[model samples]
Target chain A: MEPKRSKEASGGSGRPRGRVFAFPPSPQRGVALYLQVADQLRGRIDSGELAPGDQLPPEVELADGFGVSRHTVRQALRHLRDRGYLASRQGKGSTVRDRKRGLQVNPVIGSINDLVQFASETVLKPVSVVEEPAGAEVAELLDLEPERSRVVRINGLRCERDGAVFGYTKVYVPVELAKGLRAETIHSVPIYAQVERNSGIEVAGVEQRISAGGADEELVEHLGLEPHEPVLKISRLYYATGGAPVEFAESFHPPSAFEYVIHLRKGF
Target chain B: MEPKRSKEASGGSGRPRGRVFAFPPSPQRGVALYLQVADQLRGRIDSGELAPGDQLPPEVELADGFGVSRHTVRQALRHLRDRGYLASRQGKGSTVRDRKRGLQVNPVIGSINDLVQFASETVLKPVSVVEEPAGAEVAELLDLEPERSRVVRINGLRCERDGAVFGYTKVYVPVELAKGLRAETIHSVPIYAQVERNSGIEVAGVEQRISAGGADEELVEHLGLEPHEPVLKISRLYYATGGAPVEFAESFHPPSAFEYVIHLRKGF
Candidate 1:
């Protein structure tokens, strides 16, 4: 509870307030002392007690205040730095970074295929195509007999107007529906449109779910991001006009790159 | 290009691989050379080459491998240890923790109001509520007349079956629609259902987007995670039966905790 107090107190005082060690230091229960300190400091940061760019107390001073070694203090500072909440410099002490600038929150519906067609401009960068048996989830969505679903798994990068990697999408169309479409065609037009044109299937209802994850190596390389960067993962299901599942796809995007927007109005 | 090769080569051979350092170590970057080394290792781990539980060569051997001081290797190991990626012991060497087991992806939808009537059972934990003027995005969703828009901002945690903190949701409803609904009611039932029951409006259509991000301190606490853990952020817009925007909401979830599924079928 008090971990946040120091930060809020520091906000009003500007300079590292003398009460930095105001919280009662609890018994260290095997957990690294610096980690405890970092936890406390992080609490303050989240509570707005310590504003972004606020300099932390000198390591030696903080060590003295918390009755811990400077080594321990450094550990705590380092933890904050890796988490993107703090940044350190040689001449200057560590300062809080703008943590809120990248915070993203959204609601989950069912899948992304429902929304992918809405983009005014979309581009795809093909990575690989493989044939794989459908997983249980995929099989259920496509309404295929168990083990009967053979899918052409097409992996690619999707970009919006600015050419930023909005998502890394993996589209799975039943090989039956994908009969004549080559992997090369994915690069030119939206795969959904291609599937419709080639298979003569009109997509209708869709279900999707949205969640969060870290970028893997392949995604990092394609999206031009550091490994482990937070990314948005969207899984979508597209249905035919008769309500039969036609395709299943998943996509990922860096959190800072885009925000999902929806318009809703009151009902009469 | 080479990075991927190195990753594949190391990954294919099950042996611990060292960095390919240039001859003659350069001056240490002020931030600590070991940290730079650790960043590379972290990338490898994320790439699935250095899998969970994989052991690194002894610290001294790793020092020799990267052409750095043993102390530098120790420093790098210490960084990894703090991140929940690697575990180290005094006598034993460091091993990777199994982070892959829990990784999750966030989708791009923005609000929870769209899910208010979802047949799935709902659980809500209200944290706080406040009144605020509609921001540009919120105003647009609600189709408000500029200065006339007011909103009730309700923040809460939402979980599905089995007690997983699947999402931290924040809903913004036009003040008029939120009337008669006590903040306390948010904890028991979906607020939209309550709004409809009290005001007689039915939600019909919805729009949403999904994105990715890291868990901040508050999220870390709410979701019982380490600071900077990866999470899914969703933004959503809820519509009334007549397609009017009734509410706007956003939610965040631990990526490893939930999977978003979509089913797509060809259109006729």
Candidate 2:
């Protein structure tokens, strides 16, 4: 069947009914009917046929315009809203929303030097320094005997030039190699450099684990995040020669602060 | 200062308050006093001294035991609660919660073969396959010019052998390279193997991005996640010889389903 055009788009009816236009046939493709509607609407918005600040037609009118049920219309609207395209209220109807671009930092690191560069871009100022017996979590990360091991814990916030906090960072260094980081950190230098300079321990390998989670209370206060915000949590273990982990660092990055990129080749 | 002892823990009181143990000296180490309390309490839990289902002593008793104020005790309890260690209510007091171990999959990928192995562990069952014009997100992912490029989108859920959903996946393949994925997919086989076998287009390069995001309503319904749960999001772009993107795939993995492990050596 031919694609259906709304009365306003065809110009074959009375005054134009505010941007109602042509949409694909329902289930014409392999996608669901509601998705087809959502896709078509999204395309229209992308093409600027339906500009931001435009109030979408009422659900009843949209149902008629798309030649589908009101339920389908609601589903399509909801799909858009969930994806940050439109906003709606109980009685106020739906309106296209202006998309706000948030902060995204892409840290592409393949070596310790690269990580040093990343660290130089932002400062990790120590919030507290405490020597404590290793907990189960820290011990496992650092490959230490929980009861026998002690670590100098450095808790800090990764800050911007203006001193705005974007990340909550905690680094656990074995008490043996912890002296370098104990001195006042040069806000611009990387921790690895400080450790090497202070203790002569060289990091030869790194193991990184990247994951995501909800911002808990401490993070909310440190990162100034709204409750339930998604955070990018990265944990890294730095190894000296002979495969002993020298330092374990983990950072919690809110959406505004985290985007990690890396490349993989088929063959070395 | 000597760590203060509570009247009951000192054996100089009338009744034994629930379970008030001696805590460490506040701020003895570099850690904050409240964090010290939290760490000490967490250590007690880890050591099985305060087992799950044990209600913590009242705030006043804990304060007296730790030699900190009731405010600090409350903060320490709140910290534990936020980290999934304890549960509390206004009048119900706090109880050590039984930590449920969730499912964790560690995909250690150094090459396409490793990716195939990861895919073999779980099945991607298609929910919808639609051939449509690429949206901006898809176009950018595949490096396609939005207006002219078309892609065959395969939307699926990653499931376990028993058919339990753990992740939501979307794969966008340029129309020319999509034929392989259109066939009746063998759930055990990886997408890379299928596309290479059917279309003879080998994946020469892979670009991977790891990030975190909130579980939108759509994802909640797909992954059976609680509202506002954290999700681990992964995006991969596959390139053929000479580096044009052949496929762009992204997956949203709830915490129960995602853990990525990678290694970085100083020298290749």
Q: Give each model a TM-score.
A: 0.45, 0.56
B1-268 per-residue lDDT for model 2 (tens digits): 5534454322221222333555533234335567767888888897799898788988888888776668767878877764557766456678886543222111122444446556776888887888999999889878888958899887789887668777899888888776656447646677767777778888886777878888888787877887778898888989887777878899998765566655554531
Error of 2 at A264 (Å): 1.3
Off by over 4 Å in 2: A1-107, A145-149, A160-165, B1-109, B145-149, B160-165
Chain B fold agreement for model 1, TM-score: 0.51
lDDT of 1 by residue, A118-141 (tens): 442467778888888877777887
Q: Across residues B1-268, which tens digit of lDDT does each residue of candidate 1 receive?
A: 2424232321221122445532233323344466666876787788888898788878777777776667777877776654446767667778887643211122221223224344146577778798888887678667675556899888888866455567788899999999978876677677777877777888754555556778887787777877777887766666775446787888787767665443322121
Which numbered prediction scores highest in lDDT against the true structure?
A: 2
**What lDDT score is found at residue A18 in candidate 2?**
28
TM-score of model 1 (first chain only): 0.53
Clash count, one per candidate: 60, 3
